[model samples]
Target: MNFCLPYSATRRVLAAALACAVTLPVAAAFAAQAPAPATLRLDYLHTGNASTEQYAIERVVIEPLPWPGNMARTVDDTDRGVNKVEVVDKASGKLLYSRGFSTVFNEWRSTAEAEKVNRGFEESVRFPKPDHAVTVRILKRDENNAFTLAWSTELDPDAPDVVRKQEPSALRPIPIRVSGPSPDKVDLLILGDGYTAGEMKKFEATARRMADQLFSVSPFRERAGDFNVWALAAPTPESGVSRPSTGVHHASRLGTRYDIFGSERYVLATDNRALRELAQNAPYEFIEIIVNNDTYGGGGIFGQFSTAAANSDWAKYLFIHEFGHHFAGLADEYYTSPAVYQPSGARVEPWEPNATALRDPANVKWKKFVAAGTALPTPWPKAEFEAYSRDIQQQRVALRKAQRPESEMSALFKRELAHEEELFSRAPNRHAVGAFEGANYEATGYYRPQLQCMMFDRSEQFCTVCQDAISTIIDLYSRPAPH
Candidate 1:
């Protein structure tokens, strides 16, 4: 919603470009007949260091579009993320809505920078509009991996401080794929960044291509008809997003950029306010931003959004790999790549469905998928794999250091993937669903469900365990609420 903020120039330009906002035809259909509740958003500032955190309400917004999620699946039963948000009736204490999500702030806290200084991040949680007052609570996992209340605040949707209306957005969403009404299907908003007005057609085409690639993968392939994809972009003057590591910079609309936390390949959009403003114009439950660049970079946060380099040689892999993190909170299974997160002193079982600590191998979370006599700590060509991985990492660093052509980097990765595939093919447990050491950024102590997975490398298909995790989320959005 529009507020008298300090950015008057931005507001003026946006208002001029977006004269009127229109809702999607499918959204309109639900509104005219079996209307869902109005969407309510609670915006806040999450601040802290690695040890301590604080949250303060910034504002409450009534988004223009109705709730795009299924009314029956309001509570998130899949405990995947680092944090959880719960909205409850203030009077009766009945839980009205809940969803598990992770934020850029959470990831930042894990970086070495958090040990030295404090930081703050803007975050928002949306749910069906409530009729009365409600209590909002944020929960974080404790040492035992159980959720404990971290922050709580009372909210009144009808309060005078709430913002209800805004200047219409000039941008409208292009329907890439409309299988059914939004209430009966997953609504995915494909937002584009670093594309100029002249490249609008290119942006739409890229979005369509990526959406098609996503469905071509398993789980999504089987549930293609259960999704509705929409594409939207507010053009920028430039053709590529910021890459500060290479001395490149551009004032993109969504702040999508590379070199986050000093990791050259880590891409993310840090402007929550701008992102929400543009996204509010569409009906969506999920978002994936495709930056108009060929660099190999992208990032994803659960229940937030994902991004990819639309023109990269591995755009299809980047799209689905990052979506696994954003969609199902799947943990990265590979540990060879350079990352920004600080290593933990102890190994606690990860909340992600794909990775585990294997402290109690007998009761492993995915034990159902394990064969009768599969070893608890599945063995692979660990020594050979790690040795080759080290050499590849050195070459990767040298390529970046010398500023080699992206083609060279792509070719190097291709060779590396081929070597891995060949090595794994000879392993005895190649097709087994056993815990393989090396996952969640650690080579030891942590384990993954399978040796080869899209989350692990530049592979095409998700591992068996990952496919099941994804299907659970798909069913949550497409099926009617469990009665």
Candidate 2:
């Protein structure tokens, strides 16, 4: 874990510790001057039905890479996720390390299937290894929107049961962008799935292209220097991932595929263990999975991972839009699209930084950005928008029902975006930060920050509120907290 050793000594020690021939570009002045602790991961099982949930310890792992986070900013104050993990000193109950993240299990709980079935999901939380035992607590928001303790367990990084060593990975991380030491930069790993050895070059090129696409946006473009991007992939036996809806299935390294939760375009890797195992080889705080397919599909979960179809015509938009969810827990601002989650009868304020229930219009969550005279429930072309969206939705369903070409779907999306842009442009509050009524998959209660955003539609940039939310996380990983 010590990075203060001489260049030669550090190289030898790091090489020995990794159990692999691959070397990171960390033997430099910053590393030689600082000390970074080893990374510790707590793998656990999150299981339950719609009404009940439980957590159990699976195993602890000491990852080969050091902790890729700002040592001074170990506590997450953003409060952006449905769940939060806190590492506390067992003896003194002092908080050590904490982070906010969402799990697939929580997402599944909202599905109608969860009412009749109980399921389990593998989940993991990583932190800098502490010197002593710590009580890891998982907190979930109650009806009142406060984090209440859900589960707790004691763990010692030095315990004999801890996994201290791992078999070397056949895959090596390719440096797409090297800003600085990982501790001082947001380490983003671009992982590829469903890519064969013959398509390795294609995967790397796609990864680079996606990384470039991500940084072309507002917040990322302005703060490009505060990030380090790495690419890694375990070559699959064949190309393209499983898409059950279309009856296309292929073996993939990460087990990521399309048609998750019965949504045809929704893609996700339910294998958390596989994802963490491959990702542990690289220095990463956030992950963006790029599946080798031309289908327009991708998905994201807060503080966990995002995915995009690397060869899709809307690849750039998917790469950044899904990252909005995975990177900063930005909620989907659009409501017309069909989603897997069942409609909630209650109107509780969402934990996402973007969307809200708007119970108190005078004091909306993003109130500061609201103009002096702007209306609370900012009026837009709602009726027209919804009508247009319904027609487009029908067309979308027909395209999928008939198994139409992807190009046709892409063309439909282009038209939809064009119609939306023209409609919103004529609205009075198109650029206002007032609450636009319609977000989080609900057309009634939830509201968004602006008339349009990446989370809302196929837009190129995030709204002002979303950009601010993203900047908060960027600062959390890239620099020390203000004293």
Q: Estimate, for each residue in 17-84, the C-alpha lDDT of model 2 and write its tens digit.
A: 44334554533212532557788999999999999998999999998777778888999999889999
Residue-pair clashes per candidate: 1, 0
Candidate 1 has its poorest 10 consecutive residues by lDDT at 2-11
Residue-level lDDT of model 1, residues 405-476, one tens digit each, is 999999999999999999999999998999999999999999999989999999899999999999899888
Query: What local distance difference test score does each model get?
Result: 0.89, 0.88
* Ten contiguous residues minimizing lDDT sum, candidate 2: 1-10
- Give the CA lDDT, 0 to 100, for residue 475 in model 2: 91
Model 2: lDDT to the true structure: 0.88
**Against the correct fold, how does model 2 do in TM-score?**
0.95
